[model samples]
Target: MRLIKTGFCSLVTAGSICGCTGPSAEKPASEKYNVLIFTVDDMRDYAGFLNGYAGKVYTPNMDRLAAQGVAFTNAHVTATVSCPSRNAFLTGLRPSTSGLYNNGQWWKAALPDIVTMPQYFKNNGYYSAGAGKVFHHTPGNNPPCSWDEFQDQVFDDPWYFQDWSPEKYWLDFGYRDPKVPMPDWKPLNGIPKIGNNDWGAIPGKEEKDYGDVQIVNFARDFLAKDHDKPFFLAMGTYRPHVPLHVPQKYFDMYPLDSIVLPVIKEDDLDDVPAEGKKLAMEGNNVFVKIKEYGKYKDALQAYLACITFADAQLGAVLDLLEKSKYADNTIVVFWSDHGWHHGTKQHWAKQTLWEECTRIPFIIKIPGAKYSDNICTRPVDMVNVFPTLVSLCGLPSMEGLDGHDMTPLLENPQAKWEYPAITEIKVGNVAVRTENWRYIHYFDGTEELYDKTTDPNDWYNLAGDEKYRDIIESHKKWIPASFAKPVPSKEKYYFDPGTYTYMDRKTGVMIDGRK
Candidate 1:
């Protein structure tokens, strides 16, 4: 197929869309290279290279990739939850700027005119395709702004799920309930019915049944296809989230007795303020279910098992890329939406501004990046993916993009840059992270500060200490004056536990905390 220029908005060369070819002068100038991006869900910085869980797990695949490219030690998601975090990442804006603070909100309300990162790629004539949890939901409801085509993006499909024992478990309590038998057909209400046990548990030995694996298969085949022009493939994996389901094979990697849990310290929550205490209390609802199964060790194992499972699945994609004919020109950027907290400070989810929730994994392998095989300790956010890829692809950069161009750091990991990263849990609860410290200020005037250089465990809060007063004050200067303003009471919020019969199992509680 011959590429042609249809209008000023698009240009096409005979065999290439962008028309820029190889380093050789003999090739055309407008040829474009393929772009491959893999975004994982609820994945924290647990790779072996980061020493996140140093003594416990070994992510050989991630470590190998990090050694080949820049592994950002301080990458954060603008928002701590799924919807808001993903919105900020794809839009190249902060959650505050995007107006998507929670899953209940809509992106249109946040940045109505926002031209998403993938949309720009599509505008440039790239064959954009996505599979598995790319957008917060499936197509037609709230599809992402970008992408010319989509594949296997089951907004609710259990991508990155785990298989185990004689049964496979759902990804989250919201996805299923062991209290009841599995439903013949999934309930089709606005909400889910986890309490009703609509999500029946199944055997986990079927390794190939996991959604992330299937998504990878699609991508590997896509990469090996015959295309006349460069392509943009974004494969999203939902793993290390919850319900911690994986195949028994992955689980067998670690002995049930050997699966170590993070020490709770028993008093980890004593230092947290009222605001944090309230958040932890709300998250406990999920834990109550875990306790019912007497699978506390199983649950903990499930998380670790899920991480290892996701890592292995990730290797499959990496393997395909390394062996592909387009390996030289294809750029790979692998990242997690956000982090999760398992009994950290007595919290079991990612709804707070703690390191387990805010700090995420960010890895990028730009083709022909000047300094390959480097480690970047500079702070960054998921929003950086947009501008970074745009500039790397030789497209006209978005003027004043909310995210900074990381090309320089990718080329030189030791490059000097002092960019501070901001992550939001609520309008009043915002955390600012820098090279040596993290400062979180609550709208209610409460604060928590941690010195990563000295207290990486976040065991101590320096907000009240006079010695660190100046440092806390300095970090405050970086916070924008704006505060979070949630949508008014008129809107509806939903967190369907699962679907059930005769009863509307998907119910939600609303609060107008406006004092």
Candidate 2:
């Protein structure tokens, strides 16, 4: 491995303010390039470029990135949920390999030695810094060793600013500050507030006060400085995710009368298997409640508002990067952890094996690629992110990665690739996605098959048809015969967010944090 020695600076504190102390390395920009990863939360195919939404969506920043680089239209996630999906992609490991199947399982405890994508860059002579919801948005999930400088996720919710859990000491781990509450905006659309699923514009809050804006500021400050080494910066925005709350202007962008709801069929779940139906009915079931209150369109408006709000934040960062000195030498990768469902399949959130919860908008922009506006329809997943970045940045090759390198597809969008994207909800529940077909196999032996070429909405299931048995068998061969057992959840361990350590309840063994 090549060693590029450079100066160090502290970008996290106001005292240092990106102060560097040593001589710089004079390497060609083409020889070594910086990396910027912009990760959004729960963002689906609602962007204007993807054309997944029926109504018009405002996402110029996302569209600009797509035009500047390769857009993987058939990209999916390793796991549909936030925690496992983020963990699997960052580590380049599948759920079965990591044994992390849900949000409750602490990856720091389960896979302590697993090196994340940012850590790999940092280890290979790059200065890594990250902000916002890069991992699972938990305190201990993002260990110190993951980056040279890291910021935990900050929330702009009303509950975050209040002492809602003063009795529970574990919840008060210094992630958010207790301040005066904003004016009550709960149920802003006249719907009942189901936990944090509420959405509305804050009374006196500015766009600067939002946590995602603060995250963009973190990146802005870091990019304004002069770094000696090829830096790797991660800016993860938490929006279009939950609470769907933003400024009044964002909500005003979508009028209630003009807001368009998703094309959801009444009998969409009729052909779904028992396991698939059970997964759809899981979670908060906010769809049923929203429909009952007759505020379904209002809820969708909030979601779109949040998506536009997140896009604005992304546009700001992209603008800064464009004007910076590293603009011509930085490799940009933008992606979401997974897709989300609005009202499709009778589901309110993710954790299903359907296309609505699996397909995501993925774009990667290398500095000087051969082509622009490249759209790769080949099926790919989040696991390919780690290996692809490593290859693009000329970093040392990593071993034991479940995903294949997508460098060829970047060069030629229509490259011949046969690797199907595999997504897992839990251990045995997996979805195999190809260019035209999506095959799902549940843990109980029930299955679902959809032909994307004919039925893009996945309203029909042909898994039971004997005539298509060959197509089903072709996809079924990709599923692993055995899966690794799931790891113990956080509830089964005594977790200390301060030290980022976990003590197993049954074995009385301690799992140390990565730091």
Candidate 3:
């Protein structure tokens, strides 16, 4: 790979700062490009450009990236939860392949030697760094060796800034009370009490007070520094995830009366398989409780507000990147770990093999690429991200990755693609998504099929139909030949965030420590 000089200096020209006198000046055609990845949590295709929500959500920043890049309109994740889905993206493997199916599973414990996306870049001379919720927020999830520099995981709640101490922050933020259990979600004005399920607008707090703001600031500072080697920077934002709290201005963006809730059919779950139904009700049944209390619109408003707030933070980082010297030489990728459910199939969260829970927002902007403002409808998975980045930046190919390079699709959005996007919720439960069909195969051999052309909401199941038998058989071929049993968790090991180590629950032996 081409290498630049060790030192560089900046030059100011007519209100613009440019790096001209150094390795940046005589850049080689073979020089590797910088990579910037933005991973958002619990975000679906609610952006205005996706039109998945009938253009009701306000996501100008996300839409802006789509305008300047190629948007994968039919992208899906390998798993629906934060940990498993992110693992798939970083390792280019399905959850079954990695043996990490749920948020409780740790990647280091399951696949200790796996080369992550950032780790791969670091191994090939690039400086890798990340901040915020890049990996699952559980202790030991950040994988210190994967990054050259990783900011300590931040969980700052924008609504609480009364003190720097965790105890005071929790108490002042209404997470603790003398009369009841801390974080107990009691009904507030008829709203159900689910931990971090409530939403509101916090006034008078600057954006920097929020955890995401700190993440962006860290990324901005990284971009401002002159680097001889290419950089791989990851900025993960948590919002629109839960405890939907944002500045009041974002809440005002969507008036309660004007908020539009997702359409839910009374018999939406009728055609879903028993396994699918079980997955739908995995959580606290937040959707049912909210509907019973007649607060669906209010909940929807909070979610939209959080999404807007997240979008604003993204805009700030993007603005800074555009103004930086690396703007023309960087590739920006923005994606969500997984999708969220909003009353679809009476489901409230991810961890299901359905459209609402599996589909995600994926966009990539490669500088000097031929395509822009293009939308690719071909089915793609989050696994494709790793190989795609490696290929785009001219990095040496790594072995045994499940995803294929997406450079072909990036060059030509309308390119023919035969492979379908696969999403596995558990060990044996999986879904195959093609351009026009979604076929779900559960662990117990139960199945569900929906034709997007006829049922965009996935309201009907055609798996049992005699005419669709051939189609079902064809999709089943995409399932893995073998399954990897889930690695030991819960009982075998527990994490200690204070020490950033994983200890064996029984022996108290430290199994893994942060690098």
Best by lDDT: 2
User: Candidate order by lDDT, highest to lowest?
Assistant: 2, 3, 1
- Per-residue lDDT of model 1, residues 1-515, tens digit only: 11121221122222222222222212222455578888777888777778776347757787777766678888888888887788777878775565567776655432346677777777766777787776675212244346666674432233323222223433332454454454334431112433322221234336677677888888788878877667788887777764455566666776668866666666766777899788777667555555555555666666666777778877898899888887777778888888887677777778888888888778887554434336677888877778767656656556545677675666466676667888887676788899888898877878889989998878888788899889988888867677546642113332121220111123533221110
When 1 and 2 are scored with lDDT, the better candidate is 2
- Cα deviation of 240, candidate 3, in Å: 1.1
Pull out the clashing pairs in model 3. Answer: 185-193
Clashing pairs in 2: none
Best by TM-score: 2
- CA-lDDT, candidates in order: 0.66, 0.80, 0.77
* Residue 194 CA displacement from its true place in model 2, Å: 1.4
Mind giving the per-residue lDDT tens digits that candidate 3 earns over 280-300? Answer: 877636777777888788888
Cα TM-score of candidate 3: 0.87
Better of 1 and 3 by lDDT: 3
lDDT of 2 by residue, 212-296 (tens): 9998888788999999888989888889887788998988888888877888798988999888899999954578778888888
Model 1 TM-score, all chains together:
0.79
Residue 329, model 2: lDDT of 80
Off by over 4 Å in 2: 1-30, 158-183, 370-373, 505-509
Q: What is the alpha-carbon lDDT of model 3 when measured against the actual structure?
A: 0.77
Question: Which 10 consecutive positions of candidate 1 have the poorest summed lDDT?
Answer: 495-504
